[model samples]
Target: MDVQSGLPRCSRHPDVETGIRCTRCEQPVCPSCMIPASVGFQCPDCVRGGSGTGHAPGANQPRTLVGGRLRTDGRAVTKVLMAVNLALFLAVHTAGDRLVDRLDLIGHAYYPVLGEVVGVAEGEWYRLFTSMFLHQDLVHFLFNMMGLWVIGGIVEPELGRGRFAALSLLSGLSGSALVYLLAPPNQPSLGASGMVYGLLGAWAVLARYRRSDMRPVVVFLGLNLLITFTRPDISWEAHVGGLVAGVLLTAAMVYAPRARRELVQYGACALVLLSVLGMVLVRTAVLL
Candidate 1:
């Protein structure tokens, strides 16, 4: 078979030679032209070689492989959380006190009449989820949103979007449950602070597991817990409950499935949930 004469043989195209050489690689190319890249036309061979391109000679590489992949793009999550908090703040402020009051009806409550936190409480016990999206005041909203932005950025990428969201909801519900059990009647609380604290708690736990330093996180948590205790208006119950829940949930998520490591996490979360439920039942019985 006169393979060379049958088709204009290009050095690169062994099967079907064409009278073309890659502009970049200067290698013979067949009917298929080189793939165009930012720099120039890269022949199939060059392209394949480039696929495994490592860091530039002097460029620094991560010590761990997971470091690069686990690094999260938390900007989107931060923006959305910020916008929601800001919008709620504006709505509460512009709509006037009555509107705010009405909205607070739907907020998570531990009791039938006293736990008004955010939205209209109908029969939807699921307001625990909705209450998370609501905020009481500008200061309250901004503070929580700020924490969300900061912590969400760190945690979302590590835990992934779905798990991060689940943790937030669970933390918030746990906080509200505590408030319902421990706080006085007619005391209203609303905001994402509980969830924020939860994230912090989760981070602390996760950091411990990943062999990352937890001192800074622990200091921050301690300071916040102190503030909650000192400040009369702040619900310590919610903060403590949420914080505990966050740590437990984080442990459950990060270490639970690996051997028997999750046993501690599972036990911790179960105990907290059951304790909160028991408290709620006791409160209800006493009130009734």
Candidate 2:
């Protein structure tokens, strides 16, 4: 505020005095910098980052996946997810030989915490999530962790922690649903393969939407899916389910309108979960 002029000088244009403050940032602005918005006047900086802005400028964008991840800060969430996978793998081995079977998706096992052990025949439900964390062997654990290390490192920074976590978990659950629907009732399925595929799907969708070269990602995913089907012991159902979940969830995250991104993403996540739940209900009814 200028004592003599009876006006406030703009923060950016200090020489100019203004009678109004910006509605958004509430900073004094000269009329030139004051941009008219839906509610009120906003500064140029806010307008650039807000809904007024359209597609990101591709001229300055990176052309490589490595560039995309490294462009942001360190991927702490990726490291955390990897560490958790390692810890769960170790814990599964230490606990007991049968623990993996119990943790793996059974579509029928339900053991109450600190209570009696529940069997698939008893309608156990925790396996859907626990199975995602549990691994059958060191080889299985290493391969999945490798996928997480690579994919999570790439996706987490772009989507942030919450969105990535949601994608991973939903992908896992969708995999479980597929296994439940396709595999024999007594068969147990376990691994983070579904979530890994989900990350792949997410990366692919994001790259395609952003107009980046998606060939590398697509080829990698295709090769893995090939192996998934040819391998006798592999659960192809989990892979397909996870890939679909990842693509759908990531689409929701990336394609959401700028004005309602988080809201739309969370809603999409809920819709995915509900669809998974519906699958489980249909399977359970058939099993009963």
Q: RMSD of model 1, in Å? A: 13.8
TM-score of 1: 0.62
On TM-score, the leading prediction is: 2
Lowest lDDT sum, 10 consecutive residues, model 1, at 60-69
Give the per-residue Cα lDDT of candidate 2 at 124. 72
Each model's lDDT comes to 0.62, 0.75
lDDT string, candidate 1, 1-288, tens digits: 653465445554567766554433345566575677543344565556533232233222211111212223545555676677678777877776554444441323354343443322333444444456677666777688778888887777666555566677678778877776666645666677778889889878877877888789888888888889888777777787788889877877676543354365447556766765675566556544
- Output the TM-score of candidate 2: 0.72
- lDDT by residue (1-288, candidate 2, tens digit) is 635677878777888999875544456678998888644576676566533332234322222221222234446766777787788888877887567656777755433542464533356778888888878688988999999988887787677666777888899889888888778776778888888999999989888887988889989988998899888999898899999999998887777764576688889999999988888888888877
RMSD in order of candidates: 13.8, 10.5
Worst 10 residues of 2 by lDDT: 61-70
TM-score, one value per model: 0.62, 0.72
Where model 2 places Cα greater than 4 Å from the true spot, the runs are 1-73, 109-121
